[model samples]
Target: MLDPRFLTIPITHRGLHAPGVPENSLAAARAAIEAGYGIECDIQPGPDGEPLVFHDYQLHRLTGAQGFIAATDAATLAGLRLLGTDEPVPTLRQFLDLIAGRVPLLIEIKDQDGACGPNVGTLPARVAEALAGYDGPVAVMSFNPHMIAAFREAAPHVPVGLTTCAFGEDDWARVPPARRDELAAIADYDAVGASFISHDKDDLDNPRVDALRAAGAGILSWTIRSLAEEQAARRIAQNVTFEGYRAAY
Candidate 1:
């Protein structure tokens, strides 16, 4: 089972982020911490396998830079600014130190393979290493089950989860239809040793989600942006990972 705080606390999606505060940036993380909310952020591995607090594999959207994060070195990543702000990408090391066990943290390790096949690389191990001795209600999950499995092997004590979704083509264009069907079914939840799921909020009606809940899996949902949305999500999910607007209990 996951730490109960993850179920009860209102988690800020990519940390209470708004227009000026880019998602996954330290600014957003601090805002969430100051607001007394749990924080959820995504991490991508830099060249040295150190995890950077970021969502996109490509640097363009957040940093206005060229190339995928995998291709960039730590020195260069440390220099690139986020969303035209003064904040450079923060390492998992920097992030953990800043948080210092103040609030719960949920980390989503970005899938290394676009198709979610294998190719998980060292990101999971690196993330677990970064979280070593970190005292808090912290958990890690990934869209890629292989990544979760890897982290499970490396840090069995840390709570592990799956980032579930309906896997629609509009959003998951790179994943094949067969793979999409499998992911939507959450076929790997048990195999990866997942204790919880952050599912697509709109798809909570899927009976499999209910089945998992009935079987004692912790139910959570993502990207809720309004009070009405939060209320509806909480009807199915015990807690929410949200952004854009404030989430009310």
Candidate 2:
């Protein structure tokens, strides 16, 4: 059976945030904990191979720094503040320590193209090591199917999933339409032993999503920004990985 814990909780994307608490910041994680919501965070590898709680490949978008996040060492990332906030970018171990299994965590292992950027084949093993004994209700997912397969081998007990979207014009320009179709279809679900799927909110019409849901696998929708959208998503999905606005569900 699917874990009732995941199905029952409303997941806050990049932690719960408002005003000064930046997304994926420890402060945001604390806020989510305080509000009693499941937390979602994205992980990328630092130059030292430590998994960092972050969302973007480039640091400039959140930190105003002029380099790739994967190029920065853990020590350098730990020292920098996020968008002038007091919160520094934290390692996965640090973030896990703060949570201390108090709330469920949905960790999104980020990737570029088909691999985990510069980390390549090492990220899954690193993340598995960090999460080795964590007692929290945690799951890992990635937009890259190969990453999911890699992580599955690294942590067989941890629930792994695929995060996919139906391609828009911009997304199609980047990845060929044929590739997008394959992704949306979740071609690797069986291969990776995926327990859930976090799909794009705009792309809920996907047949693979329907097939998974029909087969009783968990289905979560991403980046729901409003109560209406959350409600709309809940009609098809079991839960939402939400952000921007507080989720009422």
Give the best candidate by lDDT: 1
Write down the worst ten-residue block by lDDT for model 1: 240-249
Model 2 agreement with the true structure over 1-249: per-residue lDDT tens digits: 335667778899999977789989889999999988899899988887789999998999899887999898666776788878888888899899999988889999887554222335688889999999998788989988777787878888899888878755475566556766677678878887888888999989877789889997899999898999999999999898888877764
Error of 2 at 12 (Å): 0.7
In terms of TM-score, the best-performing candidate is 1
- Backbone clash pairs for candidate 1 read none
Could you give candidate 1's per-residue lDDT for residues 1-249 as a string of tens digits? 599999988999888888888888788889999998999989988887778898887999889999989789877887899899888888888889888888899999999888888889989999989989999899999999989999899999999999998999999999999999999999999988899999999899988899999999999999898888989988889999888777774
lDDT of 2 at 50: 82
lDDT of 1 at 42: 91
Q: After superposition, which runs of candidate 2 have C-alpha atoms over 4 Å from their true positions? A: 113-119, 172-176
List TM-scores for all candidates, in order: 0.96, 0.93
Give the C-alpha lDDT of model 2.
0.84
